[model samples]
Target: MWIFGYGSLIWKVDFPFEEKILGFVKGFDRRFYQYSTDHRGTPENPGRTVTIIPAKEDSRVYGIAYKIRDSDIEDVVSHLDFREKDGYERKSVMFYPISSDQKPFEITIYIANQDNINYAGYADLKDIAKQVVKSVGPSGPNIDYVFNLADAMRTLFPSVKDNHLFELERNVSALLNESSIRKST
Candidate 1:
């Protein structure tokens, strides 16, 4: 079985996988439209997190795809279920690897439902940035997730255009800088 990780999964894959491939899923755009009330924030203070939205044009989300061993399927799925307990569900997605010989294949992805209570969909960059700046939870700071994922994606697949993600990252970074300047003064 194959699993795709376009956000935190890119930087943190706790599951054991036999193979990991750098890939992109077409027809979806990664945006910070989900509220992270579990992983990076509490119920009262939700953080901004990435979720795929169906794009009108041919869009792509670049990330890592891991191939799970047949023996480890049950355990991996169980772990994923608990880890994604906030508001995500399994969805089949096609992944196209960076390798020349690799062909696009389907993999399961944990996508948050827009109707879920934690869904922070449709918020502009400024609002999302503000939420991310002040939120933190068991996993860590919301900003860290943004920075880490943005850094990872840029480092791994530099060609892929995740404008929404990069824009949010820029806004977050600017907010952080502003906060630092305020404290210094």
Candidate 2:
């Protein structure tokens, strides 16, 4: 079985995989529309996380696809189910590998759609940045999630443009810098 990861899973892989492929899934836009209560924030102040939203047919969300060993499928699924229990659900989608020799194939992805109870939906980038800057949970500060994801995407897919992600990263970084300067003054 193959699992597709576009967000934290791209950089934080706690599972074992036989093979990993750089690829993308079409017809979706990655957005910070999911509230992360358990991992990045508390119940009182949830931090936003990426959830794929339906977009134009040509839209592509670049990510990594991991091939799970047949023996590890059950264990990996159980672990992911608990890890993504906040709002995500597993769904099958076609993944297009970046390598020319690889063909597109069906793979599972965890997605938090609008219908999820923990979905934060849309918000201005500034508002999102402010929330992220102030939020922290068991996983660590919310800013780490945004910064790491933006950095990972840039490192893994240099030419791809993820405006929403990069914009949020910039907003959060600026906010943090301003806060640091204010404290120093």
Candidate 3:
């Protein structure tokens, strides 16, 4: 079995994998439209998280695909399911490995269902940044998640364009800077 990770999972894969490949999936856009009430925020103060929004055109969402060893499949799935219990559901997506030598394959990814109550839906970058700036949960601060993801993506796929992610990152940085200056004064 293979596991596809696009957001935090891209940077943080707690599970052991036999092999890991950098890849991109088409027909979806990674959007900060899901509300995280577990790993990122509380029920009373939900934080923004990423979920794939189906796109009409062929869009490439860069990520990593991890090949799960047969022996570790059950344990990995269990851990992933618990980590993604809030509004996420496991869905299959075809991943195109960056290395052409490797064939593209399908893997399961945890995505937030549109009908999920915790789905934050569409919001501009500034508004999303505003919410992320002040939210924290069991895993950690919400802003840290965004910052880590952005940095990870840039480091991994240096030439890829993830506008929504980069824009939100810029806004969040500005917000943090403003807050810091205010505190110092």
**Candidate models: Cα lDDT each:** 0.89, 0.95, 0.92
Supply every candidate's count of residue pairs whose N, Cα or C atoms clash at under 3 angstroms. 0, 0, 0
Model 2, residue 117: C-alpha shift (Å): 1.5
lDDT of 3 by residue, 83-177 (tens): 88777899997889999898888889888888888988998899999999999999899999999999999999999989999999999999999
Candidate 2, TM-score vs. the true structure? Answer: 0.98
TM-score list, all predictions: 0.96, 0.98, 0.97
Which wins on lDDT, candidate 2 or candidate 3? Answer: 2
TM-score of 1: 0.96
**RMSD to true structure for each model, in Å:** 1.0, 0.6, 1.0
What does candidate 2's lDDT look like per residue over 79-160, in tens digits?
9999999879999999999999999999999989678789999999999999999999899999999999999999999999
- In terms of lDDT, the poorest run of 10 residues in model 2 is 110-119
lDDT tens readout by residue for model 1, 1-185: 99999889999989999999998888888888888888899889988888888885577888889999999999999999998877889999789898989889999998888888887889889888999999998899999999999899889987766788889889999999999999999
Model 1 misplaced regions, further than 4 Å: none
**Which candidate, 1 or 2, has the higher TM-score?**
2
Once model 2 is optimally superposed onto the true structure by TM-score, how far is the C-alpha of residue 150 displaced, in angstroms? 0.6
